[model samples]
Target: MSRSTSTPAAPATPTTPATHGPVRIGAQARTAQRPTVDPVVSGGFWYDRRRTVARVAIPQGPGLLESAGNLHDLRLAAGAADGPFRGDYPFMDSDVYKWLEAASWQLGQAPDGEHGAAAEASLAEHMEKIIALVADAQQPDGYLNSWFQSGKGDGPFLDLRWGHELYCAGHLIQAAVAHHRATGADSLLQVARRFADHIDATFGTPDSGKPVDGIDGHPEVETALVELYRETGERRYLDLAGYFVDRFGHGRLGGERYCQDRVPLRQADNVEGHAVRQLYLLAAAADLATETGDDELGAAAARLWHAMVATKTHLTGGVGAHHDEEDFGDPYELPNERAYCETCAAIASIQFSWRMALLTGQARYSDLIERTLFNGFLAGMSLDGERWLYVNPLQVRDGHTDTGDDQSARRTRWFRCACCPPNVMRLLASLEHYVSASDGSGLHLHQYVSGRYRGETDRGLPIFVNVNTDYPWQGRITVTVEECPDMPWTLSLRIPQWCRDYTLSVDGVPSARTQNEAPAQDGWLRVERVWTAGDALVLDLDLPVRLVEADPRVDAVRGCVAIERGPLVYCVEQVDHPGGGLDDVVLDPSRPLSAKDRPDLLGGVVTVVGAGYRRRLAPSGWWPYQDRTDAERGDHASPVGTGEPVELTAVPYYAWANREDGSMRVWLPTD
Candidate 1:
C-alpha cells in the first residue's frame, strides 16, 4: 500500500519550506510532521540536560578529540601543521565531524538564561575553527579524508572493506548540513556538496561515469545524502542514496555477516551482522522507502523491526549480545555479563525507530523510541554528561574485568576508538526533536518531556501548545492551548503501553470514556474540539512500580524479573545493597513496591523500594557438584539454595555506576 501524503480528516502537511535546526524528513508523507521546540522553550529534565550538553559536553568534545589525535590528523592533512598521523583507527575523521555536528546544534539553540550567550559564542568559535580546518583538508576534486589525506591509504575509495572513506564523507555532509542550517553560512554546505558531487562522479555504473558498484563497509552515507537532498532540493542526492541501498547484498564488499550484505535488503527478514551497521542501513532504507514510495522497502523495514523486538532485544532495550565480533547472536541469545550492546548501536536503534515513527505515525514505533531513550540511549552517558559507556550490560558480575574500549566494565572518560561520547553529545543536544510531533489533524505527545509545541494545522493555521509537567517521575501532564484556529481540531496524547489506567479531562470535565476500552487513534487518545485560547487539557497517567518478566525463550533470564516505574528501568547496584552481590538477589512479587524522591542522590531520581530475598551461601569446600537436601549428606544443590528476607532499593538503570562500580543487575531471580 502506497502511503499517500493526503490524510483522511485533514490535508497533508507540506515539506519543510524553511531551513530549520532539526529538520524532520518526510513530514509531508503519512507520517507526523515533527516540529521541534527550541531548547530554550523547554524546561525541567530535558532542558536541564540540553543546557549541560551546551555548557559542558560540547565544550569538552574538542579537547578529547584533540587528545585522541583526530584534530591533529586533520591539520596534518591540511598542511597547516607538521606531524605524522597520530590515531590508530582510520575512522578518526568521523569523530571530528560528529563533534562538529554537536557544536553546530549547540550554536543554533537559543539560550534560556544568562549562561546561554557565552556558551553560544564559544560554540560558534569552535564551529568556525573546525570548518576552516576541514575545508583546508579537502582536495581540489572535493575528496576529504584525513586518513587518505595523510598518505596512510593508497588512494581514495580504494578499500571499501576496511577504509571508511564514505563513512567519513557521510559524517562530513551531516555536519555541513547542520552547520548551514544553524548559521545560514553556505561555506560548509558548499564544501559538502562538492565532496558529494565528487562521490557521485566517482562511484556508480559506467553509464553514469562513476562506475563502481559497491557499498560502504559502514552504512551512513545513504542517510546523509538524503539529508543533503532535503537541504538542496537536488534529485541526484536522493538517487545516490537509492543506489547505495540497492547495491547491497551482492557480495561486493564482505559477504552477508560482516557487512550486513548477506541477503538482499528487500528480501531479508532479520537484522544480521554488526548491530550498528545493520541499524544504520535500515534507517537509511526507511528514508529511501518514503522518498521513493517503495512499498516493498517499507515492508522490509517493518519485518526487520518486528524481528529485532521479538528476538534480539534486551530488557534494557540494548542490542548485540556477542563481544568478540560486536555482532548479534542467534535468536534469544541475549546474555547479560557478556553483552556487547555498544552505545553506538543503541543510538542507531533510536535513530531508526524515530524515522520509523515519522514514516508511519505508528504508536508502537514511538513506543520503541521511548523505551530506547530512557534506558539504552540514556545509559550510554553519565548524568554529568562527560563520561561514556561503550557497552551497557544488564548484569555486572562481581570482579568483572574491564575489557578495554569495546566492553568496559564501567563508564570511561574516553575510549581508544571513541564513538559513543560524541554521538551521545549530539543526541542530547538535539533531543527536543523527539518530544512531540504534529500530525495533520493535531499534535501527538510521544515522549512526556516538558516542552512547548509550535506548528500549523492542515489549513495553514498557526498552532501553539504550551506543556507543563514532571514526566517519567510524576505522570501528570497539563497542556494549555495558547494559539490555534477556531475550527475544530484534535489533540492526541499517547497512552503509553505501560499505562494501564489513566484520566483525561478537557476544561475540567471528565472524559465520558471508561477504563481500558477508550477509543484511541493509533494508541493515542484523540480529543477533537473547537479551539480557544487558554483551553487546558489535563492528563494523569498512573505511575506505579511493576515487575516485568521476559519471554520463556530468553534462557539467560528465564526466572528473572525486571523492575520498572514509568519510562525508567530500575536496577539494583551494590551501593544500594549492603549485604551481598546483586547476582544473588531475588525479588518477591507479592510484596509491595514504593517509590521515593531521592533529591540528594544520582541527580534527583525517584528510587524504588521493594521487599526481596538474598541467597544464603552454603558452606564451601564440600564438593564440586553436591546436593544440599541435608548439610550432612551432599547429593545436589538448587540454584536458588535458600533465601533470607530483605528490603531492596533500586535506582534508575541509567544512573548506576556514578557512585561506585560494583555488582549491578536489572533482572533479579523471582522467589
Candidate 2:
C-alpha cells in the first residue's frame, strides 16, 4: 500500500464541537477533555464513507422508507395521505426516526467542505419532507405512533413486551437532538421534548399516577431521554432516564433476560436480553453515569463490559450468541455456523464501547470499537455501500438457507424488520464521532482512519491534527500537527493491542525512550510537548498474519484455528476457492502464512494465503462411524482420512458474502 500524509486545509466553519462538561451525553467528561471532529470535516477514510452515505445511502433511504410503509404509517397517523399504516410491523416509526437521524448527520457534514455540495442540499430537502411527516403524524398532545393512532382505538404504553412505543419515542428524541445539533433546527427537538414531557407525566413513581411503570419492554428511551436532557439541559428528562433504569427489575415485567428486566441496571453484572437492547441500555446507563456521576451505574456498566469481553463476544467483536431470543448464551458458547451476531448488535456494541472509552478515556474500549468497526460493523454494509447483512455469522455451511428471513448467505438491501439498514446509515453518518476524541488534557486517536481532526483541547487551545494512512490495510500512520497551542499539550495515539512492536518518531528523529522502555502511557504512545505548525509524528505498526485459537472452553472451535491479520478476522469464502469448498479446507497452523494485496478483489484487500489441505472424497457406500475389526479392516482400520495438501485463501470475515453465495468459514479444521 502507498503511504499518505494529510495536512489541514484552509480553515472553514466546522460542525459543532462536543466537549466534556458538567453536562454531556455520549462520552464521559474526560479529565483531559476532547471533542469529536465532524465527519464532513474529517476527510479520508471517514470522508469516503460519509460521502457515500450522503450521495448514495441517504438518497436511497427515503424510497426504502416509503416502500417499507414507515411513511405510510406516519401519513395515516397524520391524517394526510393514507388508509391503514403501511410497513415495518408494529415498530415502523423507529425506522423513520433512525432515517431522520441519518439525514441530520448527513446535513451536518455539509459545512465541512464542498465535497458533496449538491448531494448535501438534496439531503436537506429530503430531511425536511421526512421531518414534516413525523411532526404532522405526532398527535396534538405529543403522542406519536402510526400503528396505535391508525389501528383500533387504544391508549399508549399498554404493552411493554412488543409495543415499542417508547422505543420509537427514544429514536425520535435522538433524531431530534441530531437534527438540532447538525442544522440548529429546533423543530424536531421541540417534537421530541413534547413527547418526552408527556412520557414523564404519564409514567413515574406511585405518586405520579401512571398505568405502567417507567420501564419499556425495549430499552432505548432511557438513553434517548438522557440525550434530550443533554441538548436542552432539562433536569426532568435526565431524571426520567434514571427512573426507567432504576425502576426495572422490580418484577413487574417478569424476570426474563430477553428484555433485560431481570434485575436493576445497577445490579446487573452481565449482558442479557436482546443483543441490541442490552447494548443500547448499557450505553444509556454509561451516559447517565457520566451525566449524573453515579458511581453505581458506572460500576455496573464496567462489570457488564468485562463479562461481554470475557465470554459472549465473537472474534470479530460481534456479540449476542444465540439466534433464538437474540440474547446471549452460556459463557464461551460461541458457535460459528449458528452464530447470531446481528448487525444491529455489532453497531450497539460499538456504541457501548465508544461510551465506555469516552467515559473512562481507556484505550481498551477504543480497541473493541476498532475491532468491531473493521470487522463486524463494516461487514454488514457491502463495499459498494448498498446491500446489508442483518446477522453476520463467522461460518456459512453448504446448502444453508436463511431460515427466519434473518440470516442470509449474502447481503440484502432491506429486510421485513429492516432495523439494521437505517441503524447502519446513522452510524456511518456519525462515524467521525468515534474516530478521535479530545479530553481536558489532550487528544486521543481511537480508531485509525485517514482523516483530519479539527478541534480544541479542553483548556481552550485551538489544534488541528491531520492523519494520513491506509489503515487496517496499512499499519504506518503519519499524523501532522497543522495547528496547535504554543504551550505543551499531550498527543496520545492508540497502539492497537494486535500490534506488538511499533516505532515512533518525533519530527525526523527517533525520540529517546526513558527507563520505562518506551513513551508508552495509558494504552497510548503519549507525546506531550510545546508544538508548532508542520511538526510531524510517524508511527510504524506491525501487521502480520496470525493464527488464533479460541479459549479451551469454547467447544465449537476446539482443535480449529482462525486466521487474523491486524484487527480483521479472516474467513475462507467459497468465491476464492475454485478447486474445493470451505468445508473441505483444512489448515496447518504451524505453516507460515503470507499476505498478498489483492487489488482486484473485494474492493482491494490484503488476502491471507497458506499451505493447507482439502479432504478427498471417501469411498462410495463406505460406512462412516462404523468400527472395523483389526483382522478384517487391515490397512483401512484408521477412522479418519488424511487429505491431500492444497493452498487456501482467506479474506476478512466482514468481506465475506459480499461475493458469490456459497460456503464460508472463519475457523478451519487444522491438522
Q: Against the hidden reference, what TM-scores do the models get?
A: 0.93, 0.92
**Candidate 1 residue pairs in backbone clash:** 256-262, 627-635, 627-636
lDDT of 2 by residue, 408-506 (tens): 647888888889989999988777777777765657888777777755655677788878777777788888988888788878888887777777888
* Model 1 alpha-carbon miss at residue 571, Å: 0.3
* Model 2 stretches with alpha carbons more than 4 Å out: 1-33, 37-46, 111-115, 152-154, 209-211, 455-458, 514-521, 617-642
Q: What are the per-residue Cα lDDT tens digits for candidate 1 across 149-233?
A: 8989777788888788898889899888877876678888888999999999888965776657677899899989988998889
What is the C-alpha local distance difference test score of each model? 0.79, 0.78
Q: What is the lDDT of candidate 2?
A: 0.78
